[model samples]
Target: MEQSFPALPGQAALPGLRHRLSTRIVSLSLGALLIVLAMISGTLWLSWQLEGAGAAINDAGSLRMRANRVAIELARAHAGERHQLDAQITGMDATLARLRQGDPARPLFLPDDPGIRAQLERVSHDWNQRIKPSALADLGVATGEAPAYPAALAAFVDQVNRLVSMIEQENATKTTLLRLSQAGLAAMACMGTVAVIYLLYIWIILPVMRLQDGLQRMAAREFSLRLPVETRDEFGMLADGFNRMAGELEGLYQDLEARVAQKTAELARHNRDLAALYDMAALLNMPNDSEALCRGFLERVMQQFNADGGSVRMIDADHGQLHLVVSAGYSAALEEAEHCMRVDACFCGEAASESVVLIEDLSKGAALSAGRPASDARFGCAREGFPGLAVFRIETQRTVLGTFSLHFRQPLTLPASDIRLLETFGQHLGVALDHLHLSETARQLAVVEERNLVAQGLHDSIAQGLNYLNLQVQVLEDAVSRSDMDETRTIVPLLRCGVEESYQDVRELLLNFRSKLAHGELRQAVEDTVARFRRQSATELALAFNDAQGGPPLQPEQQLQVLFILQEALSNVRKHARAGHASVIVRNGRTFSMVVEDDGEGFDPMEPAADDQAHVGLHIMRERAARLSASLRIVAARGTGTRVELILPR
Candidate 1:
C-alpha cells in the first residue's frame, strides 16, 4: 500500500517527466500525434510519388505521339514543307526534355531507377543520334534521299514504348507502396489511441481511485490505511501526504483513546472509593458493641484491600496499653503475642506517631522506613508471614484513639487514594468507638441518678412513715401500760389504720423504683406509668398519646429523663393530689411535651410544701425535667385540680 518516492542507492533514478502528470499526458498525446503524423506523412509521400509517376507515365505516352508527329513532319519536309518540319522537330525535342527532367508543379516524374532512366536515355539517344539527324538530313536533300525515315521512326517509337513501360512499371510499384503506407497509418492511429488511453489510466485514473478509497477509509475512522506511491508524479506526492496524515491521525486517535480510558478508569476508582467510604461509615454508625463493630470494620477493610490478615486495636490510655479489640486472618500465636502491647511498643505504636504507615514490601525488612526504633521488637505482621503491611491510626481531631492494620500475603503497593481511604476508615472507626464510650458513660450516669432518686424517695416517704409508726407504737405502749380496755380498743384501731397506710406507701415506692422504660419508647413508658398509677390509686386516669408532628426520636438519655419525669408527676398525683380523676397526654414532634392533670383538692402554688411528700415529689419531677433540658410548669389552686406540663425543645 505504501512505497518510498526517492530511488534507493544504485537504483535507476526516476524520470523527471514522472513528476509532472499533466506534462506526461501531454507528451504522450503529442508523441502519439507525431507518430500518426509520421505515418500520414509517409503515406502522403508515397501517394505523391504515385501521383508524379502517373504524370510521368502520361508524359512518356505523349513522347510517343510527339515522335509520330516528327515522322509525319519529316515526310512533309520531303514534300517541300521544311518550315513545318523544323517546328515539329522543336516540339518533339521539348517533349523529350520534359520527360527526362521531372516537373514537380505538374507532378510529372519517373522513379529514380537506373533501368528506367536508361530506357528513357535510349529513347532520347535514338531521337537525337539516329531518328532526328536522319529526318533533318533528308529534309535538306531530295524526297528520295529521305533515307530509311520510316525505319528510324519505327525504332524511335519502339524505344519510346520501352520508356513508357518502364515508367508505368515504376508507377505500379509506387501505387503498391502508397496502399501499404495508408494501411500502416490507419493501424498506427488505432494503436496509438489505445496506448494513450492505457497510459492515461495507469498514470491518472488508478491513482485517483486509490486516493478516493483512502479518503473514505479515513472518514470511517480507519486511520491505518496507507496508499501506494507507484509513481513519482503528483499522485505519488498525494499518496505520501495521505500516508503521513493517516499515521499522524492514528497516533492522535490512539493517544486520545488512551487518555479517555485512563480518565474513565480513574473515575470508576473514585466512585468505588466513595462507595467504600460510605459503606464503612454506615457500618460504623449501626448500634453495635465496640468489639463487634471493630471486627466488622476490620473484615470489610480486609476484603476491600485483599488483606491476608488484619487487626483493630484500641488504646487503654489509663494503662498506656493497646487492647486488641478485634482481629482476623492472623495466627493465634501472633494474636496472643500482640493482644496487649504497650502504646510505645510495636508497629501500631509507630503508626500512632505517623497517621498512616505503608510498608509495601515488608519482606525487605525495611523497619527503619517508618522511623521505628532499631531496638524495637520484630513486627507481628512480618512474623505472621505477611510480606506487605499497612498501618493506619484510629484517631479523631483531638486524640489518637487506637490503630488498625492490614497485612498482605504478597508485596503490594497502595496508591495514594487507597491510603487516604484507609485513613478515613480509621477516623470513622475512632469516632464510632468514641460514641460508644459516650453512650456507656451516659448509661452509668443515668444509673447513678436513679439511685439518688431512690434515696430521695425513701427519705421523703418511707422514712417519714416509719417514724410516724414508731411514735404511734410508743403511744400505744403507754396506753396499754395504763390497762384501760376502751383506751386500748381506740389506740389499736388507730395503730391498725396507720400500719395499713404505711404499708400502702411502701408498696407504691417499690413499684415506682422498679419502673423502667423499654427501649427508650417514651410514649409507651408514659402509658405504662399512667396505667400503673390508675391501678394503684382511686383516680380515674385517661391517657392520650399524640405524635402528629413526626420527627426524629429523642436520645436514650433524653427518653429516660422524659419517662422519669412522667412517673414522678403521676406518683405525686396518687399521693398528694387526692384527685378523683387524672389525664396524661404525651405529644412528640420537633419537641416533646407531657401533661399530667388531676382533678383534686390542689394546693396553692405560692405556698410552702406544708409536708415532705408534696415538696420532695415536686422537687424530683422538676429535677428530672431539668435533666432533659426541658421546662416543668405546675398549675395548682386551692379549689382547682393540678396540671404539671413538661416541655422539651428540639
Candidate 2:
C-alpha cells in the first residue's frame, strides 16, 4: 500500500511534453545564433587582417625595387673604379715597352720623362699603401709595398666578382617576397568564399531554421517559449524583438545572476583586506630586527608581483646619490639585473630629491622627470626572471624613504587592485621599518645604562680591594726587618709582581669596556701598530692590505686578541725560526686575511699539535687566533727556514 493514486499524472504529461518541445526549439535557435555569429565575426576579422598584410607587402615591394636600383648603381661605381685601375696598368705597360725599345739616343730626356714616371710611381704608391694593403693576403710580397703586384690585383678582381654574385643572390632572395604576395592573393580568394558562405548562414539558412523551430513549439501551445537569439541589423532587430517576447514568457530566469555576482565581489574584497592585514601583523611582531622586516617587505612585493630582481634604493637627494641600499637577486641573472653604483650615486637619489616613484622599461624607454630610471634593466629579472621589471617607491608624508622594484619574466600590466595592494604593502613596511629603528635606539640606550652600572660597580668593589691590598703591602714592607735582607727582598718582589699583574688586568678590562666607540676603524689601528713595529725593526716589511672597511669595527676585545696573536708570531720568529729578517702583513677587504712571512730556519709545517712544548709558540698563536676570529699559519721546513702568518677577520 505505497499509495497508487497516479492516474491524474496523465494530464500533467501534457504540460511537461509541451515544455520539452519548447525547450528543444529554444536550444536550436541559440545554437544557430552562436554558430552564425562566430562565422561572421571571424570572416570579417580575417579579411581586415589580410588587407593590412597586403598593404604591408606593397610597402616591402617598393623597398625591394629601390634596393635593386641601388645595386645597379653599385655595379657602375665598381666598373668606374676598375677602369681607373686598368688605365694605370696600361700606362705602366706602355712605359715598359718604351724602356725595352732601348732607343737611349739621349738620357731618355730624364726630366721630360719625370711627369710620366711620377704618374707610375704615384699609382704604385697608392696601390701599396691603400689598394695593395686591402688585398694584403695575395700580394705575394712580405713587405706592404710590392712592385709588379699582379697577384694582389687578380685577388681584388675575384673578390669584386664574388661580391657581384652575392648581390645577385640577395636580389633573388628578395624576389621571394613577390611569391609570398601571390600565395597571399590566392589565400584571399579562398577567404572571400568563406566570408560569403558565413554571410549566407547569418542572413538566410539560420533564420529559416529558427522560424521553423519557433512555429513548431508554438503549435504545441507552449506560449512561454520564444526565439533565444538576439541580432543587430534588420534581421537582428527582428530576432531581438522576438527574444524580448521570450523573456516576458520566461520571467525571472536570469534575474538572480546580477545579485549573486555583486555579493561575490563584496566577499572577495573582505578576504583581500584580511590577507593584507595578516601580512602587516607578521612584520609588526619583529620590532627589533629591522633587516628582517625590510626583507619581509621585499618578499611580499616579490610575491605580489612575482618579481625576479629587486633592491632597496635609499633616499639620498641632498647629494646626488641613489645608493643601492640592499639588493636581492639570483646568481644566473646577475649580469642583467645587478644594480652596481657607488654609495654616493644612483637614480634613487634623484627619486628622493623629487620624492616621486620612478618606473622605467630599461629595454625600451628613456629616463623620466620625477626620478631617475637607471636603465630599468638594473631591476631586470635573472635568466629566471626576465620578461619584464616594475618599480615602486616607498613613501610617507614625512619623506621619500626609499624605492622598491618588481620584475617578471614576461611583460604584464599590474592591475589597479594589484597596484593598490603594493602601495598598502609599502606603506605598512615603511611603518614597520620605522618601528625597528626606534627599537634599536632603545636597545642602545639600555646597553649604555648597563655599562654605566658596571663601571660604578668596578670602582666601588674591585678597585677598592686592590687599593686596600696595596696599603697592606706597604705596611708589611715597612715593618719587615732590613737586617733580614733575604726575606725582605723576597716579599717585596712578590708584592711588586702582584701589583703589576693587577694593574695590567685593570688596563685590559678598561680597554675592553671602551670597545663600542670603534665603529669600523680596525685596519687603521692595525696598520698603525704595524708601522710602529716596522720603525723599530731593522728588516724590510712589505704590506698588502686588502682595504676591507665599512663593516662593523673590531671591538677592544678583538683588538687585544689580535695584538696577542701578533706578539706570539713575533716571539716564535725570534726564538725558533732564527733569521736575519722578517715581514708582517695584515690585509683586509670584504673578507680579511693576513700573511706574516719570515726568512729564518725552516721546519716541516705540517706537524702534530699534541707536541705542546715543541709547538708552544704555535699553541699561543692559535689560542689567540681563535679568540680574534682569525687563522694562524705556520710554514716551515727542516733547512729552508719558516714563515708564520696570522689572518684576522673582523
Candidate 3:
C-alpha cells in the first residue's frame, strides 16, 4: 500500500499523531482512485464476460445446427445405400422380417431382433456355404453381384437409424443449454439489483447520514463530535478518522480562541517595535557625523531593548581589534573619554572580535576575566559588564561600519521577538545611510554645477566685451597711422598700451570664468583656444598638440585649470623668456605635458627670480599647476632659451 505523511513547522512540535489530516485526505483520495480503477476493471471484465457468453452461445447454436444438418444428411445417405442393396438381395426373405419389426406403418427405424436371424444366416451362407468359398466367389465375381449383399442390408439399416437418433439427441441438448442460459441471465440480473441496493446503502445513504451529522455539529461549534466506528473497512475507517479529526478540530478551536488574543497583543507589540525601529533608524541615518549618530542610536537601543547598558563599537579593520564609541548606562567618565582598551582586554571588544554575544554568569572569577571584580562597584563592590548580551555587526558596502551590543543586567533569554525587531531596525538604518549618501552627493554636485554656471556667465559676457575693447584699440592705432585723425592720434599712443593691458586683465578674468564653457568636442575646443591665442597675441606662435583628441575629456572645471596653466605659462614666456619665435606644444608622454619654449635671456630654472625681476607670471603658473595636481618645470639657462612645462595626470 502506498502511504503519505504531512510536514509540520520547522521547530518540532513532537506530537504523536500518526495520522495527520493531510494523510487522511491523501489516503481517501488514493482509495477513491483505487475504487475508480476497480470499478473500471469490473466494468471491463463484465463486458468481456457478456460478450464472450454471447459469442459462445451464438457459436454453440451454429455448431448445433450444423451437426443436426450433418447428421440428417448422413442418415439420408445410409437410407439411400440400403435402397440400393435391395436389388442385389431380392431373394432375401429376412429383409421382410426386419422391415416388419422396425414398424413400417410409422416409418420408424430400429435395429433388427433375433427373430430376423434368417437374413444374417443367408448372407453368411452366400459368402461361405452356398459356394466353394474363395474359389466359388472368384467365379461369381466374374459372373454377377457379390453373394453377401442381402446380409449387408441389416447393418446399413442400423447405421441410418443411429444417425437419426444422434441428430435428435443433439437438438435436445441445444434446447437444454438455451434454457440454462436464460435462467443464468435472470439470476445475474437479480444479483446485480441486490448489489446496487447494497451499494446505495453503503456508498450513498449511510455516508450521507454520517457527514450530515458532522456538519450539523460543526455548525453548532461542537467540534468534538465523532461518528461511529462501524467496521475496519473504508467506511469504518472514514468514521474513525472523522471522529479523530473532530477531536483535533476541537483542540484547534480552543487554540484559535486563545491565539487570537495573543496575536492581537503580539501585533500591537510589533507595531510599537516598528515605531521604535523607525525612530532608531532615523537617528542612525540622520547624519554621517559618526559620533552623534552612534551615540544617539546606542542610547535608544539601551532603552528600547530594556537592557541595562548598550554600546556601539567599531572594529579595527586591519588589526581585528574593536573600539567602543558610544556607550550608555556606564560611568560618565568612561563613556566621555572614549576609553581605549585592546580588543583582548575590553569585554565589548572581545565580544565584537569573536563576532558573538557574551552572556556571562558573573560567578567566581568571571568578572575578573576583564580584571574587574565580580561585584557591583557602584554599591561599594566590583561590578562587571552586563550579564547577558547580544552583539550585531553593522556592516555596509565597503567596511564593517561598527558593531552594536545590548547588555542585560540579568541572565535574559533573548527571544526571536526582539531579535527580529532589532534586525529590522538595522535594515532601516542601512537604508537611511544610503539616503544620506545620496543627499551628500547631490549637495556636492550642486556646488560644482553652481561654480560651472558662474564661470560660464563671466566668460560669455565679460570676455566678449574685453575682446571688443582690444579690437577697438587696434583700430584706433591703425587709423592714426593711416591719416591724421587728430582726436584718435592724440589718445591712441597715450591710452593704446594701457587699453591693451586692460584687455589682457579682462582676458585673464574671462579665462578664469570661461573654464566651464565646454559644449562640444575637447580637441575642437583646444583648437579654438589656439586660434584665440594667436589672434590675441598677434605673434608667430607655433602650436602642436599630441593625443589632444584622446585623453578622457576634461570636466569644465578641469578645463578651466588647463586654460589657467596655459595662460600663466604663456604670460611668463612673453615677459621673461621673450623670443620673437615661440612654440606652445602639448606633449602627452607618461602624462599630459604642455611646454612653452621661447628664445630669450635665460635664468636659473630652480632659483626664484629676484624681487625686482618679472617672474611673478612663473610663480602664478606654478601655483595653478599645484592646484591642478600638475608638475611645473622651468628649464632656463643663461642664453640657450627657456621651456616652461606643465604636466597633469593622464
Candidate 4:
C-alpha cells in the first residue's frame, strides 16, 4: 500500500524527505557567521601589526635623535666644552644597545632582518673600537691634540643613522603587508556572504515559491494543474496530495455538471408544457370559431410533444357522432377518411365514451387489433400508419366536450409527468370552451334587449308626432266644410305647420338612432353637430368646450344623449323661439355641464301646456337627460331668452 501524506496548515509542507532546509539554512548562516568572525579576527591582527609597525617607526626615530645627540656631544667636546660629554657618550651607547636588543620596558624598535642585525653589530664594533675610545680619552686627561675623535664620532653617527633608516624601511614594509592581508580577508568575507545568499535562494526560496504558486492555482479552482514533485521531501508529498485532491474535485465537478444538465432539461420541459397550456388558453379565449380553436389546439399539442400529427374530435350532440373538427400534419386522405365516425366505431370515440385517456403503440398490434376482421381496412387512425398514439378525453365537470389525439412516427411511451400535464391541458381547454359558449349566449341576449329599447323610443316620439298631425288634419277638414275663409286660412297654416313639425320629429328620431360619435370622442362629435346646424339654421350657432381639469366625463352612450338634447334645443330655437343667436356651452369639471341659450322670444317654461308643440321637444330632452342621471332645467320667462342647462356628476 502507498502511504498518503496530509498537507500542513497555514504553511506548505517542508521538503523533509530530502536534505533538511533548516540544516542547509543553518549551515549557510553559520558559514556567514564564521566569515564574520574571521574578518573580525583578521582586522584585530592587522590593527596589532599596524600598531607594532608604528611603534617600531617611532623607536627608529628616537634612535636617530640619540645619534644626533652623540654627534652634538662630540662637537661640544672638540670645542673644549666637555661638561656632560661622558653623559652624552653613555646615552649613545645605551641607545645602540637598545636598538640591537629590544627592551620591553622602554619599548624600543628592533628589526627582524639578519642584514639589519649584522649592520647593527658592525656599527656597535665601530663605535666601541674607535669613537668610544676617543671620547673616553677626551673625558679623562688633557689630550688637547684634537686627536681625530670628531671624525671617528661622525663616522659612528652615520652608521647609527643608517641602522635607523633600515629599521624604518622594514616597519613600512610590514605595515603594507598587514594592510594587504586585511583587504584580502574582507574580500573573502564578502564573497562568502554572496555565495551563501545564492545557495539559500536555490535551496529554500525558489522551492518555497514554487509550492506557493501551486497552492494559488489550487485555490483558484484550477484542479487540472499539478505541481512538479522534484524531490523526495515534504513538498513532494504535498504535491502528490494536491494532485489527488484535484482529481477528486474534478470528478465531483463532472458529476455535478451532469446533474445540473439533467435538471436544466427537466426545467425546460416544464416550461414548454406551461407555455403550451398558456397558448391553448389564449386560443380558447379568442373569438374564433370552434374549428379554428380546435386547429390551434391540435397544432400546439403536436409541436409541444414532438408528435408527427394530431387531431381534435368533437362529439356532435344532435347527430350522436364523433367529428374530426381539425387536424395538423396529416395527409388529406387521412383527414377525409377520419372526418366523421360513429360514437362507438373509432379509438377516439371509444376514449370519449369511456371518458379516459388511452396510449397505444400500433407497432405491437396487440390490444388495438382485438376482435377486428382481417379484411376490414377502414379504421380511422390506422390508415395514417402511425407507430404510437395518445388519446386524451377533453371534458368539463358537466359533459365530455371532445377527444384530443396525438400520433407519433416513432414508438413512444410518455412519462407519468407528461401524461399528467396533458390531462391538465385538456381540462383547461374544456373550461375555456365552456366560457366562450356562455359569452356567446350573453351577446345574443344583449342584442335582443337593445332592439326592445329602440322600439320603445320610436313609439314615444314619432308615434306621438303622427297623432298630433292627425288631430290637426281633422280640425282643418272641419274648417273647410264650414266655408269660412279666414278660419280656412288659419286652419290650413296650422295644418301645414303640424305636418312640418311631424316631419322634423321623424327626421330627428332617425338621426338620433343612426348618429354615432366618431371614435367615441364626445368633443369632436359635438363640434360636428354644431357645424351641421350652423350650415342649415338661420340662427347663428356657437359652441364652447371647456375641459381643463379632467377629460370628458360622459361615456359614449351618455355623449350621444347629450348630442340629441343639443340638437333638440337648437331646433326649438330655429322653429319656435325664432332666435337670431344661440350658443352651446359644454364644460367638464368635477361634474359635467351643457348649457344651450338663445337670444329669442322666450316663452313661460313653467306654463308648458301638454298641447304645446314645444312641449314634445322638452319631453324628449327630459327623457334623454333622465337616462344619463342628469338634471335638465328650462330657465325662461315671458321676455327673457330660454336657457336649457343639463348637468351630470362625473
Candidate that would win on TM-score: 1
Candidate 1 deviant stretches above 4 angstroms? 1-33, 55-164, 182-313, 323-342, 347-353, 357-371, 379-392, 396-398, 404-432, 442-571, 578-638, 643-650
Residue pairs clashing, model 3: 375-382, 375-383, 376-381, 377-381, 377-383
Pairs with steric clashes in candidate 4: 16-234
Residue 340, candidate 1: Cα error in Å is: 5.5
Candidate numbers, best lDDT first, in rank order: 1, 4, 3, 2
Cα lDDT of model 2 by residue, 111-213, tens digit: 1234334533443454446443443332233444443334344443343333334333433443454455556556755775676577668666787788778
354, model 3: CA deviation in Å? 1.4
lDDT of 4 by residue, 1-650 (tens): 33334546744544452255555567768877887787678767655654654555565556556555665676666677855766766776776676666764544546568877887888878878887786676554454565556567567767767876776787777677767877887787788778878876776677789778877887887778877767555555566677777777888888889999999999998897778777877777888876777777778788788999888888787987779888887888888877886655544333333444567666665334233221121334555677677777778888888778888878758887788888887788788777778788888876665455555556555676678778877877887788777877876777677677677667766776687864448888788778867766788888899978685556777888888888778767766777889899999888989999988999886674666544767777887788789999999877678999999986
Expressed as tens digits, the lDDT of each residue in 206-309 for candidate 3 is: 87788888888888998967887654445555676678778878999999989998999999998988789778756765556666767777778778878887
TM-score of 2: 0.33
Reference-based TM-score, model 3: 0.36
Segments in model 2 whose C-alpha atoms lie over 4 Å from true places: 1-263, 313-356, 360-387, 395-400, 474-650
Task: Give the TM-scores of the predictions, in the order they appear.
Answer: 0.62, 0.33, 0.36, 0.49
The predicted structure with the larger TM-score, 2 or 3, is 3
Tell me the deviation in Å of residue 97 in model 2. 99
Model 1 lDDT, residue 580, Cα: 86
